[model samples]
Target: MAANMFVVRQTKGTVLCCKCGILMAPNPANMCVTCLRSEVDITEGLRKHATIMHCPECDSYLQPPRTWLKAQLESKELLTYCVKRLETDLIKVRLVNAEFIWTEPHSKRIKVKLKVQKEVLNGAILEQSYVVEYVLQDHMCESCTRFQANPDQWVASVQLRQRVSHRRTFFYLEQLILKHDAAVHAIKIKQMDQGIDFFFANKSHASKFVEFLDKVAPTKRRESKQLVSHDPKNNSYNYKYTFSVEISPICREDLIVCLLELLLVWGISDRL
Candidate 1:
C-alpha cells in the first residue's frame, strides 16, 4: 500500500499546467501552456483595432489610414455600447452674453429723428432714418467728467441698442477686445448717448472694436414681443428684450489682456 501511494503521488506531480500554475489532470500534454497561448492571441486580436495616427502639424481634418479608421470605428462601437448600458445623460452647454437692454415707450408726442450714415465696402453710401420719442428732462450727464454743470450736460434723445447677443457673439467680441487692449495697454470708458463706448489709447484699437461689434451685432435677433392678457378690457402690451454686455473699464481692460493672450495661443496652436 505504501509503494502504491508513492507511485500515485509521483505521477500527479510530474505534469504541471504552466499557464494557470496548477497540476495538470490526466491529459496527454500540458494543459496551461495551450490555454495561455490562446488567451494571448485573443488579447492581441482585440488590440489590433485600436491603432490611429493624428496630424502633428495642424489639428485639422486629414485623411485617415484604413487601419486607423477601422480602429476608430471599433472603439466608437465599444464606447457607444458602454454608454448605452450606463444610460448617461447628455448635457447641453450654451454660451450667453451678460448684457441686455431695457426700453420703455411713451405716449407723449415728441418728435425725435435719428440719421445714421454709413459707407459700404464698395464705396456705396447707406443712410437710414428712424423716429424716436423721449421725455426730455433736465439732468446732469452721469457719464460726463466736466467740472462745471454745463447746460450741454443734458441727456440727449438716444436710442439704446446692445451691439451683441447673449451667445457666441460675445466670445468673438471678447477676443477682438483683448487684442486691442493688449496693443494699447490702457482703456477708457465713456458714457455715450446710446449706451456706453469703450476707448483705447490707440485709434486703431477703437476701430477694431467697432468692426468687431459690427460683425457680431448683425447676428442678433430683432424680434419684438407683445404681452397679451385674457381680460377683454385690458390691452396687450409690447415689450422687447435687447441684449448688451457691460463691464467696468478697469475690469474690461484686465479681461481683454488675459483673453487676448489665451486666444492668441489657442488660435496659433489650432492653425499650426
Candidate 2:
C-alpha cells in the first residue's frame, strides 16, 4: 500500500515540460513555473506603441479629455501619461524606472525606456524593460476648440453694477479675485461702465463668483435666466444666466455721512 501511494504522489506532483523536456512539479500552466514564464511572455498585454493627445496651440497634452485643474508640464507626468495611454488595460504594472531614449520635438516622436514590474506566482514579481515609442498627435481640446471657433462666446455673465462709478472699486475686486483664484472658471473679463463683467462657460462658475463677492462685500443680488437653446432628443436644457450684483454704496468712509444724511432727510436712520 505504501509503494502504490508513493507512485501516485510522484505522478500527480511532476510534469514533463513541453519546451525544455524537463520533469518538474506541475503548476497552473501545466508546466514548471520557470519554463512557463520563459515560454509565455508576462508583458503580453503591454503595448510598444502609443499615441498621445497634443494641442499645438496650448502646448498641453490631453489627459482624460478634460480641463486639468493641476499643472502637468513635468517630465514625470508626461511620461506617465504616455505609458498609461499605451497600456490601457494592463493590470498590476508598477513602474520601476523610466528613461528617455530619444525625444524629437520637431517630429513629435518620443521614445522612452520603461522598467515595469508585475506579480507572477506566490507573490513573486517579474521585471521587464521595454522601449515604448510615443507619437504625439494633434488633437484639439474642448477649450481650445471653442476658442479657435469663437473667442467671444460665453455661457453666463456676472453683471456687477455698483451705485457709484468708481474704477478703484473694480480694481480692488479684481485684485481679490486674482489673489483667491475665484475667477479660475471665468474664460473672459470685460470692463463695463461701473464694474467689470466676468463671463464663464458654466453657470456654476458664475454662482461661485457670486458667493465670493458676498463674502468680500455685502451685496444685494438678483438673478435671471434666458433660454438659449434646448435639445428635446437629449432632454437637455441650455440657458444663459445673468447675475446682477449691487453692492452697498455706503463704505466705511461714507458710513457716517450716509447715516447722518438719512437721519436728517428721512426722519430717522434704521442703522443709526
Candidate 3:
C-alpha cells in the first residue's frame, strides 16, 4: 500500500482601497480601513424631515420633562432633543454645536445646523455636518388646552390668609414658591384683600402648597371638600378640595422669654 501527501501554504495579503489607493488588511472589499469606514454615511439614518411640537398661542415648545409636571422646553433644549432623535446606533455621537438659521420670514419650516463628531471603527472620529429641517407643527399641550377651553377647571385651591395684611410676608412667600418651581403646578393665582388664592388642577399640588407654607411659617389649616362630579358606571366620584391656611403672625424682631418661676407655679416643671 502507498500514501500521498501535499504541503499547504498560507500567505499574508494586502488590498488597495477602492476610493483611495491605500493599503489595508482584513478588508472585505478593495478599500482601506479609513476609507471603508468613512464610506458608511451615518447621516443616512438621520431624520431629515422632523416635526417640532409647538404651541403658537403660548409660544412654547414641547420638551422632555424631568418631572411629572407639565413644562415647556427652551429653544436650545429642544434643538438638543431633536438631535438625539435623529441619531442612530451606527455611530457614537458627540454634539459639537447647533444653530437655527433664519431663512425667511413667514416660513413655518426652520433650518438647523448640526455639527457632530462620530466615533467609528478603530476609535476614529468622523465629523459630520447636517442641515436638518424641522417643521413647526401647531400642537396644543394639555395644560394650554385646559387654559383655553376652561380657565377655571381646577380641582383644588389654597386660600392663604394672615390676620394682619402684610405685603412683605406674601412677597417672601411668592419668592419662595417661585424658587421651588411649585408655582408651575398652579393653574391660577388670585390676589385678595386678606391674602392670595392659588388654584391647582390636582389636589396633590394644593396639598404640596400647604406643606410648603407650613414648613416656612407655623400655620393653622382647615380643609373642605365638595362633590363636583360623579361617574355612575365607573363608580367614581370627583370632589373639589379647598384648603384654608392661617399663618401665625411673627416678625424677625419679636421674641418671648418664659420664666422658670411661672412653670413652677403652673406645675408644668418636669421635677414637679
Candidate 4:
C-alpha cells in the first residue's frame, strides 16, 4: 500500500486594502482579508462612487450618482434601439426594476434588480418581484386577425398605490403596449377604485387589452386563469380572463405588459 500526500507552503507578501489603506498578508485573489470580507464595498469603490441627492418635490433620496444614472439611462436607450431593430410582431420593449432599496447615506448606488417582459394574454400575471439580481420576464401577443368595427366600449378599473417611481414605470410600460397596432385601437384609461380602469370597445378589444395587461402583470409561481363577468345591461356577452403573476415589485409594469400582449395575441389566434 502507498500513500500520496503533498506539503503546503504559505507565500508571504503585503496586500493592501483598496479602501482604508490597510496593509495585510498575502492571500488568495490578491485581496487583503478585510477587503475580501467587505467584497461588495471594495467592488463599489472600484466602480464609481455614487452620490445621494434629494428631490424637493417628493422628499425622497435618489440613489446612484448622477453620472451613473446617466450611464444607465443611456444603456436603456441603447436597449430600446436594439429592440426596435428586431423584426418581429413585438411592438414594444421595456426594462423594469423589481426591487429597489436605498441603503444609508443616499448614493446613486441603488440595490436594483431587473427583468424583461414581452407579449402577454388573458389569465396571465404580468409583473412579479423577487429579492434577486437580474431575471428575464418576457411575453408575446397572439396574432390578431378578425377585428370588428364600432363596438361598444366599457371601462375596467383597479386601484393602485400612489408612488412616483412606480407610477412612472407603469405608465411607461402602458405606452409600450400601446405601440402594438391591434392593442392600440379602442383603448382608453380612467382613474378609479384607487387604481385605473382600462376601457375597451368590445369583448374582442377587452381580450386584446387583457393581453397587454398580462405583459405588465407581475410574476407568480402558481398562476391560474379565472373568468369574470361584465354587466348584463350591455346587450352583449362580457367576460374577463384573469391570472396571477409573481415577480419583483419594481418590475411589475414590464411583466404586466408582456402578459397582456401574450394573452391578446392568443385570443386573436383562437378566434382564427
Global CA lDDT computed for model 2: 0.74
**Which structure is stronger by TM-score: 1 or 3?**
3
The residue pairs in collision within model 1 are: 57-272, 97-166, 99-244, 100-244, 101-242
Instruction: Quote each prediction's TM-score.
Output: 0.17, 0.45, 0.55, 0.24
- lDDT by residue for model 3 over 209-249, one digit each (tens)? 89988888779999999998899999999998999998777
Model 1 lDDT tens row, 50-81: 21223211111122222111112224432333
Query: Which 10 consecutive positions of candidate 3 have the poorest summed lDDT?
Result: 65-74
Which regions of candidate 3 fall more than 4 Å away from where they truly are? 1-50, 55-82, 88-93, 96-114, 119-124, 128-138, 163-166, 229-237, 249-272
Clashes of 4: 81
Candidate lDDT (C-alpha), each: 0.34, 0.74, 0.71, 0.39
| Highest lDDT against the true fold, candidate | 2
Give me the candidate number with maximum TM-score.
3
Name the regions of candidate 2 deviating beyond 4 angstroms.
1-141, 151-153, 256-272
Runs of candidate 1 exceeding 4 Å displacement: 1-168, 179-186, 190-196, 201-205, 215-272
Q: State residue 51's C-alpha deviation in candidate 2, in Å.
A: 17
lDDT order of candidates, best first? Answer: 2, 3, 4, 1
* Residues 148-251 of candidate 4: C-alpha lDDT, one tens digit per residue: 23222233322223333346655655577645543444344456433454444345565555556556654233222334455668856454432222234556
